[model samples]
Target: MKDDKKTDKPLKRQETEKTQQLAEHTADSTGELMNTNHGVRINDDQNSLKAGERGSSLLEDFILREKITHFDHERIPERVVHARGSGAHGVFKAYKSMSGVTRAHFLSDESLETPVFVRFSTVAGSRGSTDLARDVRGFAVKFYTQEGNFDLVGNNMPVFFIQDAIKFPDLVHAVKPEPDNEMPQAASAHDTFWDFISLMPESAHMIMWLMSDRAIPRSYRMMEGFGVHTFRFVNAEGVSNFVKFHWKPLLGVHSVAWDEAQNISGKDPDYHRRDLWDAIESGNFPEWELGVQIVPEEDEFKFDFDLLDSTKIIPEELVPVQRIGKLTLNRNPDNFFAETEQSAFHIGHVVPGIDFTNDPLLQGRLFSYTDTQLIRLGGPNFQEIPINRPIVPVHNNQRDGYMRQTINRGKSSYNPNSLGNGYPLQAKASEGGFTSYPERIDAKKIRARSRSFFDHFSQAQLFYNSQSDPERNHMIDAFSFELGKVQSVEVRQRMLGILSLVDKGLAAAVAFALRIPVPQDPELPVNHSIPADGNLADYDPFTVDTALKASAALSMANTVKDTIKTRKIAFLAADGVDEKSLTTVKAALEGAGAIVEIISPRLNFILSEGDEQIPVNHSLLTAASVFYDAVYVPGGTNSVATIEAEADAVHFLNEAFKHCKAIAADLGAAQVLEATYFSKKIPSEFSDQTVLREGIVVGEDPKKLADQLILAISQHRFWEREKPRKVPA
Candidate 1:
């Protein structure tokens, strides 16, 4: 069989042309003369046409009016949520045919490459907000398949904050900046958010995720994405099964420390965005394994949690994900607004095999996405936008809306008309036309939730129990920090009460930090969002003691830690640095797929021991330890002394140590290590085991040090060092 892998084959012209259509609207004026919007050459663009040099501009100056009018109306309405986002172009290919499970062409065809556009974003943040906000990330992917566009609109976390779509608005309103003051932008550490969360027990499971390390991702390329809701996959025979989507990054899931995340937000507000753009630009394409947890329709009720509940997750232990395909993002968008910003994703955009379940939240989004695009993208016809257009031809009776790019020529615009001879007729299911699963329903309409969704604290407890020691500590610290920011005593106390349901120790830790007594007997049957006519006793959440105490998959500590690809390593050096030690280590890291940057006392160039000018990528004044994944100090007689004397260099190493990042130095640079605040905490011997455990290496052999540093960086971070040997950088 011919190989269908994108890496093995050249990009097809059709795919290039699809993207090029948008490129035609783009222009670069590097060597071109200035011209008006109409392409007319301008003799005096700097000065508008006027009666005199300083006199009022003439009203007849079409150039001036056109320029100002275009500038004035350049902005579009940003997304109400997930306003800050970065997108990339890519292709998805199935590893093998999934025809037995689903009839979706993209999933069943192994030879086809489906064009895709993925947008990574942070929820609760506006277009101008910082990317490091501790919140859920929007991981929506638009797959332009032969059948149509299938949008797997998801979030980084597997669950949401609410069970039903009815509470979505209330959840967003509370998490957003207070309407009165509009304060605490892109943050959920305020009283309003906690007040709402404390009242709604259904949000407990999602809150655990929000407070965990997953909320603060190191980079968009290093995080995981989930479809959040349980969808349905129907085979050609009309057999249906429950399915959940997952995107597991090939780079492994990793995250920055909460403190480091805050520092990054201040240092570079566009940290995640820049990281993704730079990775693709440098040819380190980000890739993810598409996985699905398929649950037989009959077995869905076997789980303790409700499959329809958006706030629960079917643990990996219960249903292991089957890795069936790959999604590679190889190209960055050319224009941010034209492509990335204008892109629209809808949960309802499913093809033949892919169908929706009765998930309340998913049902609500089916209506919300199209309604939002109607106003946000300017009327209805948003799918016609180049970035959003499907690969297949779109032919329908509907036409002529705002921003109508297609000029249709037909005598009849409606169906059942002989004037056009039924030209744009619909296709049958056998002909690749979509057909919704004929799900039977026989029940009275009511405003209520299933009794199965009443047990909300079980998964929350499982999540807390599954975390590693260091992860648990981080969660405690996170809850403490967030609650400490809450000004309302009532909200803080109530949140502590809610936390107690998940874990008593976690609640006690936050209570101690807040200097408030934990409420011994807080409100039971807590669900303030229950319907007005509903029975409070029946609506109260029940804490189920799940058979599984913990699932290792819930913790990031168990994530892949075998490669350091795309990791940024900063080489600390100075004038008269040992050229051999610097060059050898730099080569080893670069060869390992790690990006190496030279940092010295000053930018431009630094003289090495051989008197060769080594270019510096960043200076001590401009670079921060938080910007790199690891730190290395090369050796030199004068270089060690100069770096030792530089307080910023000493603090750089110390800060890296504080954040549990790998730190390496040549034996000759002992003086430099000794100058740092963390030097005294280093172990006496540098054994192979100790080096890996401590994430600190000091040796004479350049090659050995470089190899050990590569292994240390692959571990991501030495989180074990955070609490035991905490230091003041």
Candidate 2:
């Protein structure tokens, strides 16, 4: 619950701290005299001290020795997961005061625009791996709130592959490149992954999300993000509620085809990284509304799924998300290594109003994060690294450790001391000090999981049942493609058995792709994950029937499609191009906020029929249609003939068509389209409905053609055309 009104407090610190911090780091470095680490300036930096001009160097050359030593040890250990990442500087502003639900200053005050640093990453990849890998994206945000730092560390997918954190290592080891050969770099198509998934029934729900188009997002700006664990929001009145966090992209949830994702990996491994950087540079800042789903503490066990299970979701149908704030990433990082790479996030980093739940996975992460940072950052003082530091001053009685940046004077490093007059005093809960909720716990200690976390397939079934036909087909193809890469026949069959438990038709589709029959009893290895002490006959995975058969929010097909903002559209034109048609359509698309890039036979520029020099964004040799949202060909006698004759140009259109993107051509340029394979397969009649379904726009008037193409682009893709009009590139 929020107050829906502004707070009385002023926001001077929240609004200006971001710029002040950036200035503190960068402004001091400007015009600084070159000096060594000891603040000694050396004039002879070019050469080391030597006995003579051509003699051997002496050990007394401190400048050269220091420079070389520093360069050799500059690198720190990378993160174990989410190693490949892109970060940006942003701000988050609450839409209204949420004082009714929480006392966290940032959320309770609507006037404050809190500074935040966000990092988006790929989970299974290394620092040098491609950004287009089909893996979960880490969507972590660090809010420099007035009280302290709050890191909303989460992922693009709402559910996880395991219910407990103990199985986290196993999951990662299976998905990572195999230890022996390490043949695959950043993929999960190998046997180890399927073998692990086949045994862990809890993985079924997350596997469905991984196999869907959600794995290959169109851009970092177009994907949805979710906090995968349930948390507690405690109000000042001593009331609590179970809360889930969400980040809904203003650009809407959209994704690339699996085929297109593979092509992008080859064409540009840093596609997402580049997209985020270029958008911020071009002033098209990426935006997402911060959303949350809150269920009263009394209603926690009212749902079929357990609230404490990380693998389960509180389907939006049960508790609708309330968009509470807006997050806008308007600035790119100043330095990649110092700002983006060194930044640290932790799930345990929270203010007073927020607290943890008994979620097993979450409880484990609270310990793992600090330990991981200590090893990776070289010290416990990693928070002093500016990027990870909060806006408010940090005061503590703890003494220095490795790489300690703070200098303390006076005795009394311990609390309750008469000397130093009891400095650095602690605050009470009434005075904004952090405190955990006092929930009574009287249960006995046990190493067993609750039976409530056993019903794993209902939500998985709910997810599969919610997908549209095109999305379902894509998932089927994804499973077939990935399982086909798995070498072990037994692993494939075991996975198929698990799939059958979710849905028969799904298993049949993938089994047919692998040229195998579906298993009669799909629950063959259901007890494979049981512990050694557990009885095989007693192992049972509860199956709870979901009251809801499907949820519209689970499918990307029902996402927002009213705008084509920031959509990249390619214009395939060459010498003697029709200036009127090309310029008119480009203006129209650009006016509607779409990015129009001209791709011709060669780079730099092209000649129009009116002898006007038209600039080209890229050449066909360098530009691939997979990098664009749509493709268009304008009419001109010479231009059309040249384009049709050029094999690469024709291939561009064909590949775009194959990827299910919108395509268009002027009526006079119809021959250019005919040169492609699918031109004859689609409807010849140019009815608006027929044209819309096929994602092909053809009209004599430039304005009319532009309008039709805009509509097609807004639809994101014509996925239905993919199955019937499969074309060659």
Candidate 1 — worst ten consecutive residues by lDDT sum? 1-10
- Local distance difference test, each candidate: 0.89, 0.89
After superposition, candidate 2 runs with Cα above 4 Å error = 1-12, 27-33, 42-54, 523-525, 684-692
Q: Residue 453 of candidate 1: its Cα lDDT?
A: 82
Question: For each candidate, what TM-score against the reference?
Answer: 0.96, 0.96
User: Model 2 over residues 60-88: C-alpha lDDT tens digits?
Assistant: 88898999999998998889999999999
lDDT of 2: 0.89
Q: What is the lDDT of residue 143 in candidate 1?
A: 87
Models, CA RMSD each:
2.8, 2.7
Q: What tens digits encode model 1's per-residue C-alpha lDDT throughout 199-263?
A: 99999999999999999999999999999999999999999999999999999999999989999
Span of 10 residues, lowest total lDDT, candidate 2 = 1-10
Against the correct fold, how does model 1 do in TM-score? 0.96
The list of candidate 1 runs beyond 4 A from truth reads 1-14, 24-35, 38-41, 684-693
